[model samples]
Target: MITSRLMVLRRAVCVSWLSSCVRKQNYCSSAKKTRVREALTSLDSGSSIRIQGWVRSVRLQKNNLFLHVSDGSSLHPLQVVASSDLNTRGLTFGCAVDITGSLEKSPSHKQRVELQAQKIEVVGECNPVDFPFKIKGHHSLEYIRQFPHLRCRTNVFSSLLRIRSEATAAIHNFFRDNDFVQIHTPVITSNDCEGAGELFQVEPAGNEHSLDEENPHFFSVPSYLTVSGQLHLEVMAGAFPAVYTFGPTFRAENSQSRRHLAEFYMVEAEISFIQSLEELMKVMEELFKASTEHLLSHCAEDVELFHKYNSPAHREQVNLMLKRSFNVISYTEAIEILNHSSEQFTFKPEWGCDLQTEHEKFLVKHCGNVPVFVTDYPYDLKPFYARDNEDQPRHTAAAVDLLVPSVGELCGGSLREERLELLKTRLARTGLDSTYAWYLQLREFGSVPHGGFGMGFERYLQCVLGVDNIKDTIPFARFSHSCPL
Candidate 1:
């Protein structure tokens, strides 16, 4: 009797071991399936595939389920159909899941393809009660702004971000193909590039209270966040002939507008051995075209979304923009056009004054709505670094502002003043100290006529994606009075 009992116990143990081995094999096989994109392209309809992604939306039916999953590549969602026994009781929105299924072309007219899921495993769970995006209604921008961490999971935000990444890559590829060496410029500097007095002051460690004490401050010299990388790139251009810097730049202005940001990304390029301002304009045109064409070709889904949901006028404008060559108008001509216009502007266009946002919009909207390079601004209105045109009026400089539809001032460039004496005189007249001795030394030693401009990365993203707010262009935005997650 004892021997028979021992035999029964051993057999039961062997059965349990076999069951565990089978379960392990099943898990390993599921892990080795192809990605969603690959599965969709393959001609085999019954091929086994597995995909893992965050749950975008979940529709629960009495006998089955429908889920939209996004793995963060394209804007299109992967449709997943699950059976009733998938154990989805604890699953909620934004939950991560692994699904093993057969890839099938869509039978319904709406979907392109569908995944008939055989097994669904819950990789992670999200609590619906605590989640901010659980409701099935459109959330206001202000309310959605509170959840920056989870906001990217939304359809609109995700689409905008995908376009932003594509546009940035396109910009870099354009510079690389044109023999421009990428340079890293300093973020903290003593000199102001824009000369606009809108820089954010950077306080040194242990000197936080020095300003209050009023003893000339025990600080290691005050430094401020750089508003532009133009000066630094100019110095580099003298050595490298052609170079560009793409990085973060900060401004301290408190204006609350759709176009302004406290901190933003800038792309500054300076090229030496350039003959005239026309060459600079050509480079700007090529950069704009390259970036726009890249996004339009590669990001079809995102572009479609922009056309559908964004302003109706925007689609027509974008189509018209790419159809023809951009127009070139001098600052004087732009003033004339604006002055003659039947539409009234708040700040009327004048020859000596800077182009306000309203004037830029009018020029783009009426004048073919294509990118325009408005050149020859009043030197006094521009930075001290811009090269003054000897042939033009007294304060006029050889500067150009690249204006696009819905995005004003995409790029700003000029022929830099390379003469040492003239630069020094301009700096002194502008009341800026000659503290940057090295920068001035470049002009003194072996300077050539060099010119460059800074393009805001977020601004380019806004134009490419047709997004209105600059805050949504970046993953983690730091704007005035707003920094959520």
Candidate 2:
């Protein structure tokens, strides 16, 4: 009887709270809150609306106060006109304001509509002196990158972020449309996807230097951050015909260059029943064209800003890439072209040596400045899992790399060795047979010829937007000696 009475009292209290909320919501609906982007495009004139945003610019005319405000809804800001008396000392650039106004057609030729403010409230104030960004200042990418916390307030970084978000969704949709399964690969792993040994080992905060002393090594053995999710995706490919993983991949690379980051995102996909590199290249080409097309169609204004301001030549390059089919050449042919070219290279291209950035850029230019697939790399240059071509004098693996004009080596992939005997011999030669015992077991159980490719998400953004620095493509950069929150 006591429990039933308490339940009735709780129901009455909930009803009272909901009724109060509904009353407040209906009252606030008088000046319907609207985003700048929605208001600019959809809302009709002569509608009462409320807008909240930071001040981008403040103009004082003879009798009127004009302020341009943005809520990061779009690249353009909404123009607000008010009486000069409404302007106060607290109203400054970078200051936040809540505005209730009537939308009206503008007399000026610049914009189609403008906001006529009836009341303005200064919700947040900015001194403008302490702010890293200046109003109407043209800051370079490097200059704005210093203030990571406040960089999104700038025009360039903000647009890049919006484009990045759209590109991410587009890639996922591309996979889903093609019947590919998405897998969430782990950040912590017992295996090194790449045997380069540049891994960021993880452990408890206090036991940084405990390296195999007596703590049982945390995970029983040393575990490190994954440099690539390809191996994990390969495991999923055994269960599903097509699978992909997109997530942050960490490496201990000590690079501060425009194209390298210690922590970056990768889009990796694996497909079963593919015996040739051509099948893999087809998917790579389709993904590039599809994702780029999506960005151009959906985020035209944001993408155009980069093409117009950053790289004027890239617009034509991108159009040509979409129109023409990508070029393909063997690794041996690429080396010959490099050796014969008159252009001086820092790292000389050789048949067995890995292709450097300079070499990759030259290859793309040699192939009419379009994306070129360089296939059949030397056996020694590839990782242990690459399928052996088994050619006589010149040994090579069935590996391929897709190199782009601006961004070299956009994607890398190979046909994985599915034969148990061949894989076992290769792993044993490298003294990693015991380490990869489970990987070898996959071949023994049931395996079909499969191939996959990994594309660097940052590099893809850099290519599409003509961004010179890879750091500018990602929201937060993690490089050597630097990790800003």
Candidate 3:
């Protein structure tokens, strides 16, 4: 759903390790430094501090030289005041600077404190004529996207990166708090977990041995980038009570849609001894609520930038989601609701057909635009591992999908077919029985009833931020052919 320019910005300190390397150092190396966020909250007026960051704006008055500097510690920048004589040719917007100043109370009501500069030096020079981002105006997300290498310098994307970083930490904290063992699943695998045929086949870079179709494979068999970690988590489920994995996943999908991406992250969790879809849905719902609450509390300022500017109406939508309990409806009832709706859908609603994007959106809207769980899908629509519902007249699978207002399907999961005979019979229909012999073995020995769901990480970000495009949610977007540095 999203990749970003600030590839691995640590939420712990806003910028952390990268701030030291992001810009050139052209000032004193003796004095200790203070992050912009740390200085902003300091109550000691007259305390000496040095800050290094890109100059956001510069104002040269008759005697006073004011500069706004930010090191990505927070959404706001620190205001600096100096003598006009201290301002030089290099003190311009987008230029990185290091300044030693004393913290003092600000006369302006906009901020609590301002820096009274003792000395200022331009560490990294940036030409105003060539800088993609200007000093006086805000750039659109689309305009900034063309320059992925420098998008992090912009206020909009920087705030987004900070929020993304905190959201990641919050998720980790949630799973750890719930006693879910964090499992690092493999990125490359021999099995196609989604079975969608959208796998990105992997191979060596060079033909050292002059390999071909009949020759030996790299792993002696076909392998591709993982589409999901659910199957691997299931294997862990056999030995552990609960396990979760959060990592990148890939799909060789040929599209440039706003909601699609070639690579994204997923949070997959598997729980042993899970009996029904209700228990699985409870976990999913709780995760969402917990993560969102954490974001609202920790990333209030950063999130406000989106709620107040990017998507003004999203603030109310988020409140509604947290206030109301998610509604539940069966697949049959969802089809009935779609059939009775006045809106005409391109893919007509039917009994066994999978729900299209339009249908999913309509269902969410019908449920008062809150998150809704639609369960008990047709047997054929679900994957091979979906436990049989055993309703003879209308066969269905114990599967469920959590659909949000903007994002059609944020998560999908189902109870695995733990019965050895049923799983073997299902795999036999497609001649995959032998290929999945190890998977069958998981059920054979000490297999307990288990279920898990994988939520698209980027989609979750998009859903909360009300970001229109999935690309904006991520840092460096990887699509069909556009992979930026």
Candidate 4:
């Protein structure tokens, strides 16, 4: 009887312990199932949602906490309200967090929505003392430039970047739809495409030497960063009827103006057997219109901000640009117009003189906000590769520069000199090496009438966004005095 009682008591104790273990396992499983909710830009009233983003700002009241969070999508902030038990302590600006809440339409403002938080999860921490950005006031461009990595988090910079991205996509789509083959050109080039002596030299490893070195340094071959990809695109155009190259180009020019950059992007296109400069101008007009219209359709918020802050003249300019047809004029006519204009230019307009930025701006702004292509430049003023007009005086070349208001000389193009003999004569005149035997071979093999143009990508962005500087258009700007993270 005693043994039976002991066995029964032991069995009962074992069963009780097993039941407790099972209960604990169930509790753990339920806790592990808890997860963050999906993110929605705008939530309907009386609907529960969860959001995750960096905390932009925070306010603490006696019994509640108000937090503004940004998820890097829109310019506006999402207002989050949390109760006192949500552990608001150690919550600093810029820290990432996840919040579960019921969204409600703002009683005071119809445009705004509020989230009342039921739970809060801190994903990351930020030190307020060391944080570079603040929620109180705006920072100057010069100050924000110091922190390039962090500046993109701001409203203005974010808007500019979004627009830049949309513009790039629009350009690619335009070219793709027009049957233009996208070509990638080499960056480290041995040839000078732009003949404008503004090239950044690259030396071989261990080739550094003093200027007074008696003998040429070992492994020192003259190399340079390409100023343009026009020549390379021509080679591709020979294979493909229509081709374009969009990539980075570098220049060593010591320009201190808002227009120039040490390194910038260029969009270059070359076509084979093109009919006339008129056709080329048509392409330019269509491309600009397509790019602008695409951006306006997609980037509404960015366009609104751009018009509000940077260019109050955006609506009028865009309307004028869309309605007005491009005006075709010769270099001589451009000079005449500049000389007749009331605005006195720094460099007085003269024949054979390259159009100054001031001269080009006046022609575009006053002559109607349409692109003007000034063609048939004086032979001596153009590069050796440009086709010279036989009928015109001074051996003028068939070159064109598309100028627009605010952004002068947006593009430059010319019909290539196809005649081998004439090209050789022009090359000799310009002092280029005849040793470019491979390039000459293209003409020898059967070169046809071809023309191409190069548009400054940053300049286009500047015009579209109405941003003041080229540095802001690019993510990492390389300038004279500054190169920062």
Query: Which residue pairs collide, candidate 1?
Result: 379-395
Q: Candidate 2 deviates by what RMSD?
A: 8.8
Give the alpha-carbon lDDT of every model: 0.74, 0.83, 0.84, 0.75
Q: Which 10 residues in a row give candidate 3 its minimum summed lDDT?
A: 1-10
Model 3, span 1-485: residue lDDT tens: 01011111222322211233222223222222244223223235675667778888988888998888888766778788998877566888999888887767778776666778888889999999988888877788888889888999998999899889989999999999999999999999999887788999888887685576676678889899999999999999988999999999999999998888999999999999989899999999999999999999888878988988889989899989998999999999999999999998999999999998899999999999999999999999988899999964689999999999888999999999999999999999967898899999998899999999999999999999998889998888999989867
Q: Give one digit per residue, the lDDT tens place, for model 4 in 1-485.
A: 00000000011111001111112212211121111001122224656656667888989899989887766555566678889888765688888887777767655452345778888888888887888888776765556767888888777787778787888888989999999999999888878887878887776454354433654433355678888888888888778889998899998867767888888899899989885787787888888889889988877777777777767877677767777888888999888887887886789899988888888888887677777888889988887788889987566888999987788888899988888888888777666746456667789876888898988988987777666777778888876666575
365-459: candidate 2 lDDT, tens digit per residue: 98998999999999988899899998645899999999998889999999999989999999999999999999998887779999999999999
**Candidate 3 vs. true structure, TM-score:** 0.91
Instruction: Name the top lDDT candidate.
Output: 3
Residue 290 miss distance in model 4 (angstroms): 0.1
Once fitted onto the true fold, the runs of candidate 4 whose alpha carbons sit more than 4 angstroms away are 1-50, 100-114, 129-132, 140-143, 204-220
The candidate maximizing TM-score is 3
lDDT of 1 at 149: 85
Inter-residue clash pairs, candidate 4? none
Stretches > 4 Å off in candidate 1: 1-40, 43-46, 104-106, 109-113, 134-136, 139-143, 204-219
lDDT for 371 (candidate 1): 81
- Cα-based TM-score, every candidate: 0.85, 0.90, 0.91, 0.84
Candidate number that wins on TM-score, 3 or 4: 3
